[model samples]
Structures are given as C-alpha cells and as structure tokens.
Target: MDPMKVEVKKIDELFRLDGYLKPFEREIRRRHGVLREWISKIDQLEGGMDTFSQGYKHYGLHFQQDNSVIAREWAPGAQQVYLTGDFSK
Candidate 1:
C-alpha cells in the first residue's frame, strides 16, 4: 500500500490557522508530523485500538493460584523500580 502524504498548505487552509499561528508555524508543523507518525503506526497495528490498548490488562497486579498475589509493570526506559507494600498481616 502507498503511504499517505500530508500537505501542509491544505491543512493550513482547511484549519485557517496560519494567520493566528504564523509565529509558531515551525513548532506546529513538527507536532503535526509527530501526530501523523502516531496515526500511521496505529493504522498499521493489528486488531486496531482495542488490542493495542489491552496492554494494561496484561501489566499491573493480579491474583494467582494457591492464594498468592502477583505484580507486574512495564518500564523499559526506567533503570530500576522497587515495589514496596505490607502484604503480610
């Protein structure tokens, strides 16, 4: 499939933001680019938004067999994380 192209002039005209946003045009364009990239990625993801966002269900805390508890989290960028709690009564 051919990648979609974003035309800045068409967007500027459609939104009528050029006059009011001229001073910040560059920043606006950069943010628009980031949004476009995100859109493209979401569109390419299989099973759409529901499957992509189901990450929360797989992360976090849960209860397991034999009356035990489990905790989990996704923090790829973090150097370390410590889980602290008084699970004992």
Candidate 2:
C-alpha cells in the first residue's frame, strides 16, 4: 500500500477514536467536573488543545445582498493567510 494510504487510514482511526472518547469524556466531566485536572494532564501532549474544541459559527444570518463573507480569524501569530474556495470566488 502507498504511504499516503497508510496516512489516510491513520487519520481515519484517530477521528473514530476521538468520536468514541468524546462521550466517554463528557460523562466523566459531567460526573466529576475535572476540566482542570484533564487540562494539566493534557498539557503534556503537543497541540492537545487543538485536538478538542467547542465553537459556535454564525453562518447565513440576515444580510442585504452579501455574497462576500467577511471571514475573520483571530490569530495574532499569523503573518499571512489567504482564503480560496468556491464561496470566495
């Protein structure tokens, strides 16, 4: 099998594991409220915070002829970034 195929399989497994762990962790947090404890342990892993996220996106709100979506990303560390998509076109 190709290296890219192996990589895709690895990513797919990781995503499925995360899906299973989400409910397990949610129940633990619901029963114990151990956010701080988990944070301390999780901090040792690189990019652990990026692994789990909670966000709300306000899409398609009432607007007057605005095909142009003003996308704003709050990243001070970013030097340059560009958006390219069918929506942006």
Candidate 3:
C-alpha cells in the first residue's frame, strides 16, 4: 500500500445502509466533487496531500545552528503584520 495513494469509495455505498439518503445523493455528490477538486489542486500545487497537510513543519518559526531564530507566517491578505514574544522585546 503506497502512502500517497488515496482509495476513494463509491458514494452509493452510503445509500446501502440508509435509503433515506437517496434523495440527497445529488447534493452529496456535488459536495464530494468540490472536495475532490480541492484535493487534486493541493496535490498538483503542493506536491501531494501528505506534503500539503504537513505545512507546519516548513512554515513556522525555526532555529538555526548559529543560535539565530527565524519566524515565518503565511498570511496572504494582511496589510501589516507584527510578531511579539519574549524575544521581540
């Protein structure tokens, strides 16, 4: 089993357990399509879902061997930004 492979199950499987869900199948499938699109976009843009989900490991503050600290934030719509901590003072 490859870690990067995603196994997708049929949407009709849910209806097997509960027939009441039959009416909502269309909406459920639409939502699922949107979700699949997002997943595909993440895979193409960020290597894969595994790498995209683990962004915290690469995006946040990190310490260097020279005792220097680096801080990083991913705020795309911010007009201004400020970082405060004991080190900031």
Candidate 4:
C-alpha cells in the first residue's frame, strides 16, 4: 500500500438513492477534507491513529503487579482535579 496513493470512493450511490442530498454534496466533501487533515495531524503528532485511539488503555486506572493502583487523567482545561476512592484516600 503506497502512502501517496489516495483511493477516493465516489458518492454517486448516495445521490442515486436520494436526489435531495445532491445539493449538500460539496459541503460533505469539505467536511471529509477537514477529517483527513485531522487524521494527518494525529498521525504525525501521536505516532498514528492506532496509538492515539488506544489512549483509554493508558489514561485511566490500572493495577500493578505489586497491588498498587495508578490513576491517571488527561484534563487540559480543568484548573484542578481530584481522585477520590478507597484507593485514593
């Protein structure tokens, strides 16, 4: 699979199913472009979509072999965060 080769699927089937959607086709394509840009950015910054999407496995509570609990959160906007539970106390 060549990285430069872009396989574009036509949306003609959608317009065939409903003529009303034809007017909004341009907007749909623009939105797809935005999505592609975001995907590219994530691939460059986060080492590809597979690792970026699997953040749940890293950014949450986990138990270690020593019976210790680790709590982690990614909150960029919050001024403060608190972890409360039987293990946290």
Candidate 5:
C-alpha cells in the first residue's frame, strides 16, 4: 500500500524478467538501493532534481562581456588564490 514499498517489488519483477541479469541481481539491487537513497536526500535538500542540478552554475570559469574571463572557486579554508593566464585582447 505504501508508495515507497513499490521499489522492492519492481526490482524483483525486473530481475525475474531479465534472465541475463540474474548473475548480477544482488549487486544490481544494492546499487539501486543506494541510488534511491541518494535521490531521496537530494530531493529533500534541493526540493527537486532540476534545482539540484543547477548548483553547477555557481562555480567554474565564466566569460564576461568585456572580453575577459573570471574563474570562481568555493574554497572556504583557503585564504588566497592566484590566477595566471593570458586573458588579454
């Protein structure tokens, strides 16, 4: 009756349907369990998958309109960082 209980039954039927996967059934179930748990945590923390994936936009190198590039990093423990490259025009 519980929605969360569906994954177990589905996994069982899935393995039964695929004879070739029988050899890896145990490992497959274990990985599926871990994947489900991680999805649940991400859903709770980010509200949804779309928002969670958008987190990548916050960090990395970005280009500006002034023909310059900026690099960003989230290093809380580091006091300073240096950038060395040719970003001139």
Candidate 6:
C-alpha cells in the first residue's frame, strides 16, 4: 500500500472513466454534432475545464468534480433564461 501505488490506481480509475466516456462521447457527437463541435472547442479552452470540472466559474456549463450536473448552457442567444429549481427559493 505505497503512496505511489495509490496515485497510480487513481490515474488508472480516470483512464477507465475516460474509456467508458469515450463511446458515450462518440454517441453524443453523432446525435448532437453541433454541440459536440462546441464541446471539442471548449475542451481546447482553458476556461472550460474550470467551468466543467469545478464550480469556480459563473458562466458556461458547471459540473461536479465527478461530472454530475450542477448547471450548463453556454447558449447566449434568446436572451433571458430561467432555472425553475429548488435552489431558487
């Protein structure tokens, strides 16, 4: 139970998740070509990881560390959006 082993295991877990998400990602790209294209661009942007992986940004998509949905939608058109959620109250 060495510390290096622990780090390696964690990295392996991420690789597994990356592998698992890879197919779903492809499916997403197929189903939502435009969104997938935007996602690819976002991945290229530094701000995206901050917004996607952490709640440190006040814009774009927000996701938990594990990628559980917190919020999203980079769409800026059709001004005036709403989130009818329990958090509103």
Top-lDDT candidate index: 4
- State the displacement of the C-alpha of residue 13, model 1, in Å, after optimal TM-score superposition: 3.5
On TM-score, who's better, 5 or 6? 5
Off by over 4 Å in 5: 1-6, 75-84, 87-89
> Which should have the higher TM-score, number 2 or number 5?
5
Cα lDDT of model 6 by residue, 11-73, tens digit: 445557687654454343355555555777877874575566764466555667885666665
Which candidate, 2 or 4, would have the higher TM-score against the true structure? Answer: 4
lDDT of 6 at 9: 22
Residue-by-residue lDDT tens digits, candidate 1, 1-89? 12124335575674474577666666666777777777778768646667778877777888788778777887879998999888786
lDDT of each: 0.68, 0.47, 0.76, 0.78, 0.73, 0.55
In candidate 3, what are the lDDT values of residues 31-69, reduced to their tens digit? 666778898899898899899989888789898999797
Indicate the worst ten consecutive residues by lDDT in candidate 3. 1-10
Please report the candidate that would top TM-score against the real structure: 4
* Model 5 alpha-carbon miss at residue 63, Å: 0.9
Clashing pairs in 5: none
lDDT at position 36, candidate 4: 82
2 or 6: which has the higher lDDT? 6
Report the number of backbone clashes for model 3: 0
TM-score of each: 0.56, 0.26, 0.70, 0.71, 0.61, 0.23
For residue 53, what is the lDDT in candidate 3?
Answer: 88
Instruction: List where candidate 6 sits over 4 angstroms from the true fold.
Output: 1-31, 47-51, 55-89
Any runs in candidate 1 off by more than 4 Å, and if so which? Answer: 1-10, 14-18, 39-49, 64-67, 77-79
Evaluate residue 41 in candidate 1 and report its C-alpha lDDT on the 0 to 100 scale: 85
